[model samples]
Target: MPKIEEAQPKYLQIAHHIRDQILRGDLRPGDEVPSERQLASSWKVSRPTAARSLEALSHQGLVEKRQGSGTYVRSLEVNRRARELYGRAKQTGKIYTPGEYAVITSAGWLEAPDYVAEALGLAVGARAVHRRRVTNNDSGPITLSTSWFGPEVGERAPKLRDPDRIREGTLMYVESVTGRQGSYAEDRMCARSSTDDEAADLDLAPGAAVLIVHHVVYDLQDRPLEFAEATYPPERWAFEQGYPIV
Candidate 1:
């Protein structure tokens, strides 16, 4: 058998093909899209290629993938429900107010990564305090935060560096020192199978859920001051972002 060669990016081809179907009304709004395996067989491509195609479609707002359920074409009639999950991850279980300070501490070993170095204008391998805290809400089990800070600040404010101290707001302290506040927050959310480490952190059952989140808080100057790799348990938290759904 000759190896299947990709004349075009498999996902793009699949997306264009499916899009054509939609445009032609063959795959109407509210239509049930083919499953990954089905798409693979139909296109004679691998499952991964088919999966990517579906994901591309979803990103383009052409389809929606429900957890554990199959993908479906979105209705052009009404918008998909979007909710900005406010952080309830404090013992007080309240929205964070400006000037409120949250203690930072960690559960495991913490070290700054290269990305942090670049963002914070620090030398690579320069010491930075890192912390991972298990944040909780009134309902319980908020997302886990792996936060980092430059050595100057973290050394001066140990509580700000400790992840276990896990208070209500750290952004306040951030503002106080930097003399600035975050103007825009950038989040890159992605759906993925939960790994063992992620499962334990998010308190999820094995192989039973998708983890979604990418939180980047930038200062008024548009410099990335705080970067959080937040992991949410499936169905526990819904992310809200201003994505053009056209």
Candidate 2:
């Protein structure tokens, strides 16, 4: 548990307290956090101040506010690895972090799907190195992704066709062999009802809401290297991004 730092803002103190509880497993998904009234009474702060504290937690994606009920810890955790894979490219050579499972279900050359073609700037019917993978967090399977690498990437790194987890992760291996490091990436995300196959893969009920993420990775030369579509059960994963508004 985090001690309330006297110098820190009151809202930060509260946010840290809640965040620590979640991290330490004291609070589980769907667990109700203390209500603002309870917090105000306990912390001796105004109700507005307590509400602000919860709002801070909401902004951090640690809690969700229900319509009738008070705030609760989110069922999903923010996927820091997903963001760090590209965000820290310049500072670190690492691609994936530990504590996750990656299983390659399929990998081989395949005709690019329409969306993959568009994202990778490949012509329709172009053959690309395709890889299907399932990723699991501590809770369980969280993401199913299909990635397509452009010919430039495939020709440079043939091992991408291997049907196994790349020990150092794809980006790290690609950079080591191709020297085309992922300098940055663009992502689009949306939520929609899961298909039967998707539902089964994610162990969710049919028509349950799922999050989809599309990513395009670019090298330092601004050349497209890979395009991918990743699906996640909303209750198992959360996404976050931070960038300067240039």
Per-residue lDDT tens digits for candidate 1, residues 90-137, read 223333322223324353324568876776677887777666655453
TM-score computed on alpha carbons, candidate 1: 0.50
Best by TM-score: 2
TM-score of 2: 0.65
Model 2 segments beyond 4 Å from truth?
1-76, 86-99, 242-246
> How far is each candidate from the true structure, as Cα RMSD in Å?
14.6, 8.3
Q: lDDT per model, in order?
A: 0.59, 0.75
Candidate 1 minimal-lDDT segment of 10 residues? 77-86
TM-score for each prediction? 0.50, 0.65
* 55-171: candidate 2 lDDT, tens digit per residue: 988987889999998899986565433444443333344444345577888998988888888888889999899888887766777678888898888888888998977766677
